[model samples]
Target: MKVKAYITLKEGVLDPQGKAVEHALLSLGFQGVSGVRVGKYITFDIQVRSEAQARDQVEKMCQKLLANTTIESYQFEIIQS
Candidate 1:
C-alpha cells in the first residue's frame, strides 16, 4: 500500500513560511488573498496487507518521526499501488 502524509502546523501556531508566501503574493499584486498555510506532503510505500494495519503503522510513523504533535498536525490517506 502507498500512504501519503500531510503535515501542517496546528492552529494558534505561527507559520513563518506561510506568512512569507502570503507576503510575496501580496507584493506580486495578487488580490483577494487572506490567509496561507504551508504544509508538507510525504508519500511512501508500506508493506502492509490491510488498511487497518497500514493506518496503525502510518499513525505510529507520524507520531514518532513525521510530525511534532505539539505544534504540528498530520493526516494520511492510503492509496493502492
Candidate 2:
C-alpha cells in the first residue's frame, strides 16, 4: 500500500515561510493573495496486509515522527498497491 501524509501547522501559529511566499507572490504582481500557509506532503509505500493496518501504522507514524501534535496536525490517505 501507498500512504500519503499532509502536515500543516495548527491555527494561530506563526508561519514565517508562508509569509515569505505570500510576499514574493505579491512582489511578482500576483495579487489577490490574502493569506498563505505552507505545509508538507509525504508519500511512501508500506507493506501491510490490510487497509486498516496501513491506516493504523500511518497514524502512529504521524503521531510519533511525522508531526508535532502540539503545534502541527497531519492527515493521511492510503492507496492500495
Candidate 3:
C-alpha cells in the first residue's frame, strides 16, 4: 500500500514561511494575496496488508514523530495503489 500524509499548522498558528511566501508573491505584483500558509506532504510505499493497518500505523507515526500535535495538526490517507 501507499500512504500520503499532509501535516499542517492548525489555524491560528504562526507560519513564518507562509508569510514570507505571501510577501514574495505580493512583491512580484500578485496582489489580493491576503494570506498564505504552508504545510508538508509526505508519501511512502509500505507493505501493510490492509487499509486499516496502514491508517493506524501512519497516524501513529505522525503523532509520534512527524508532527507536534500541541502546536500543529496532521491528516493522512492510505492510497491503495
lDDT of 2 by residue, 13-57 (tens): 999999999999999999899679999999999998999999999
lDDT of each: 0.95, 0.95, 0.90
Q: Clashing residue pairs in candidate 2, if any?
A: none
Using all chains and alpha carbons, the TM-scores for the candidates as numbered come to 0.95, 0.97, 0.94
How high is the lDDT of residue 51 in model 1?
Answer: 94
Q: What is the lDDT of residue 28 in candidate 2?
A: 97
Q: Which ranges in model 1 have alpha carbons more than 4 Å from their true place?
A: none
lDDT of 3: 0.90
Clashing pairs in 3: none
What clash pairs does model 1 have?
none
Prediction 3 TM-score vs. true: 0.94
Q: Candidate 3: misplaced stretches above 4 Å?
A: none
| Minimal lDDT window, size 10, model 3 | 71-80
Error of 3 at 50 (Å): 0.8
